[model samples]
Target: MFNKILVGIDRSLISKKVFEVALSFATATGANLMLVQVLSDREEDYPQLPAYSYYPMWDDQTVRIYQQQWEEYKKQGIEILNNLAQQATEAGIATEFTQMSGSPERSICQIAYTWNADLIIVGNRGLTGIKEMVLGSVSNYVTHHAPCSVLIVRDTELLPPQSTSE
Candidate 1:
């Protein structure tokens, strides 16, 4: 039985499935569900290039752009988390949401360790070959390295909800 359940959610359509699975498990066990969103700092991604730029006489344009983009990303992430939390709450489950900037896998594992989560729920885009090798799958990483158990919900095609015919 899980006492603490941590679910990784992005703003992608796949996250909705992850949320459903997490909510069902949380409801069944009455566990505290923690929703996490990870955002990477753009500056970290583009390191080799000059950290700043400017027009003719200015030299802070690039830094300013990076900061603006980072803030916008965080704002978008927060909105996604809020929407997920709202949905989970409406389903009669208690949920907490948090965001951090870094490697998604690292942040997720650390939070799982910190929360001592009994289980971790994640979504799989089914990335393989080159894509999987270059951009490691978070679910795969967690499954291999998490301190606790992990549940990976594969992205599957779902049938449309049955319409009640009058």
Candidate 2:
């Protein structure tokens, strides 16, 4: 029986479905839920890539722009996490939230392990083949690396549509 459920969420279309599944499990087991969202800076994350490589030349303006964009992303992530936490609270589930900054897979797994989570609920974006290879799969990474059990909710919409003619 799960006593501590950690749910990783983002601005993805499948986030709502993922939350619903995690909420149901938490409610059934009376488990404490922890909602986590990662706010990563693309420039900082891939520092190996020179900033001037993406532009004609490196300039203060470019740095400022990148900093502003990163701040916006962080703010949006916090708002989403806050909303999710409020929803969970209203549903009578004991909940807390953390906004982390780093690789999604690493942050999620680290939090789960440090928090002593009994389970981790996450959504699979269903990337495959070339895309999966290029971008890597967060759910797959978590499944392999997490210290606790992981439940990856596949979005129903990701499936091929059924034919009406049938």
Query: lDDT winner among the candidates?
Result: 2
Candidate 2 C-alpha lDDT tens digits along 1-166: 9999999887787889999999999889999999998764322332232545475575787677777766777787788888888988998999999987788899999999999999999998888899889777889999999999999999887877888973
Scored by lDDT, model 2 comes in at 0.85
**Per-prediction TM-score to the true structure, in the order listed:** 0.81, 0.85
Model 1 regions lying over 4 Å from their true place: 41-58, 157-166
**lDDT by residue (tens digit), candidate 1, 1-166:** 8989999987667788899999999889989889998875322332232433434544476667667766777887899899889988888788899998789888999999998999999988777789779778788889999999999998766433567988
Could you tell me which 10 consecutive residues in candidate 1 have the lowest summed lDDT? 42-51
The whole-model lDDT of each prediction reads: 0.82, 0.85
For model 2, give the 10-residue run with minimal summed lDDT. Answer: 40-49
With candidate 1 superimposed using the best TM-score fit, by how many Å does residue 90's alpha carbon deviate from the native? 2.4
Clashes of each: 0, 0
Colliding residue pairs in candidate 1: none
lDDT of 2 at 161: 85
